[model samples]
Target: MSETAPAASPSAVPLIRCRGLERAYGTASARTVALAGVDLDVVKGERIAMVGPSGSGKSTLLHLIGAMDAPDKGGVVVAGRDLARFDDAAAARFRREEIGFVFQFFNLVPTLSSLDNVALPARLAGKGASEAQAAAQKLLDRVGLGNRAADFPDALSGGQQQRVAVARALVNEPQIVLADEPTGALDRRTGEEILALLGEVVRERGATLLMATHSDAAVSIATRLLSVEDGRITEDRALTPITAPIKEHA
Candidate 1:
């Protein structure tokens, strides 16, 4: 009988781990590979940025880590659960309960007020409406959107809406926050403000953040900077002075 390799030691296990991860679409003649043999480890409370240009698999990697998508090969383990181990239904629940997401487009519902939008996740998690709304209010206030809580998405500027999105992401108190090009749609000044808010909140909560962006300013907020090109990471550097100003925004 053959024996499997022993599991990695506890001290070596990462909060997020991707090993030989790959994602491909279509078959032989039309196969498009988004990722190829990627390996990475994100420790608890670590803030890392994945920087890459269009079609470089940065978003795909983020999705895979967030349990929104599965890998075609290899594995992605998040919060100690491997992506390959979960069925679709389980993965969806895991996403709702364990991962917080902030997208560039700010996916808030048009009909809901900013407060309601942030509270939706808590409601989904089974909190009473009043309790959830109160929690939502606290988060919104922390993000500097307390006065805009009753405003709808259409009434807010891009940055304000994104701040609401950030607040919404924290509603569930997820262990890992995944942001994909969160500042892509905002003006430089507004984007900086949103990024600063995100950094502050993540630090205060001591949650791990893995954000993917093409902006140098975005990379500057990260404690560790990783560069991806041609669907592969070419460099990974830990910035000594992460607080240094990179791009002057606002």
Candidate 2:
């Protein structure tokens, strides 16, 4: 079948689009449905929160859009690149260069220093070691982790580790950032700090954010909210929205 989606007007073109998306696991008798016929379009510069109960398909939708998993019956397109057309290598390249991800677990490499962990994606995208480290250092400084660059994941506090994760996500300068429960591992105070930093940097970079979360802190910065339930999107609405960061005095 052609990967064509129903035509959208030029002005309404989305940076990410999902259509008839369906995903399931297990055999028919014991199958578990994750997403059922989800249709979503995300324009650039919007912060959207995908919220629901733990098993409500939010993460499944994230995984599909992030190229971590595939839909059973439909397709996803991001930045006009059809995810269905991506082979393993293409998907890796796409993920390395086109999108970023921050997970609940602060998935940093245990053995790599904080700087290396953040630099991994840029390096994978074919940067020289110095170039990748330079970019990583800049982001670490942005996330308030410049001093911790040489520390390994084991040496950092939970909040610090998450800061590293955030820096890592932005290292590639991706147009889209997918975060799943990004603050789940941090304490309340730390979570808020990280979320604020995240929102600030993403807004400054003009990148779109799609996060699957249950935290009010995450929702507070969102421009749109999507509530998924029992494998489908049940509600989508606009919120107060995140405006650009206020300029600071010199």
Candidate 3:
């Protein structure tokens, strides 16, 4: 593993910081390095896209930042707290309250209605059922799915389900949102819509967003782009302003 990267400058605290992060899987003979001394810093409200081929560690980095998993070496700091130092309980609390995650598959409970699916996190955090459902409804409205709130995930279209997933991620009003190929399972048009909704919602909330995806449409929506290759960040650059697609008259 490489030496730890220096801490972020004190002038402006980064919302997410990774220092010499490393993770490996399997036995010595079959070891696979998922991350190799990676370093990164993301400011609040920035939309960062991690693009890479399969097995390039984009998801691994996001997982580490989201505190879903611990690194084998080095550390991750989010919202000024070191994730490496968090005890199991602390880690669980941090994930539940401070961070939001959207996965490639809509991980909604099949038995739950869209409103319940979005409200589940808040319920888990101790909010009253009515209050949580109210918040979830507003988020669904924001995602253009207000009419589908009472429907179960099985009854919704893939796009609608993914929109519900986005709503669920925002229910807690977290400081950061992490998405792993959030639009991967959808068609190109649907994926574009999801990306636009994600960008709009995260920007409106003033929350940081870190997404791992291979879609160029997804990359275009990001303010910054990072390319991961062979477990290392090979390119990091600010993207030019992204204009909304032009609409043709009917």
Whole-model Cα lDDT of every candidate shown, in order:
0.85, 0.89, 0.88
Q: Which residue pairs clash in candidate 2? A: none
* lDDT against true structure, model 1: 0.85
Q: Write the per-residue lDDT of candidate 1 for residues 1-250, one digit (tens) a residue.
A: 3354223344755889899889987899999989987898888777888887788899889988988888888898887787888998888888888889999999999999999999999999899999999999999999878999999999999989999999999988898999999999998788887887787788778888999987767665777888888778888877642553333343
Q: Would you give me the overall lDDT of model 3? A: 0.88
The worst-scoring run of ten residues by lDDT in candidate 3 lies at: 241-250
In candidate 3, residue 233 scores what lDDT? 96
Candidate 3 on 1-250: residue-level lDDT in tens?
A: 3355332234777888899999999999999999988998888878989999999999889889988898999899888899988888988899999988999988999999999999999999999999999999999998889999889999999989999999999999999999999989999888888888888888888898999997888766788889999899999877863656322121
Better of 1 and 3 by TM-score: 3
Encode model 2's per-residue lDDT on 1-250: one tens digit a residue.
4445433344878999899999999999999999889999998988998899989999999999999999999999998999999999999888888788999999999999999999999988889999999999999999888999999999999989999998999999999999999988887777877777788888889999999888887777788889999999999877886565533221
Question: Which segments of candidate 3 are over 4 A away from where they belong?
Answer: 1-10, 243-250
Ten residues in sequence with the least summed lDDT for candidate 2: 241-250
After superposition, candidate 2 runs with Cα above 4 Å error: 1-10, 242-250
Worst 10 residues of 1 by lDDT: 1-10
Q: What is candidate 3's CA lDDT for residue 196?
A: 84
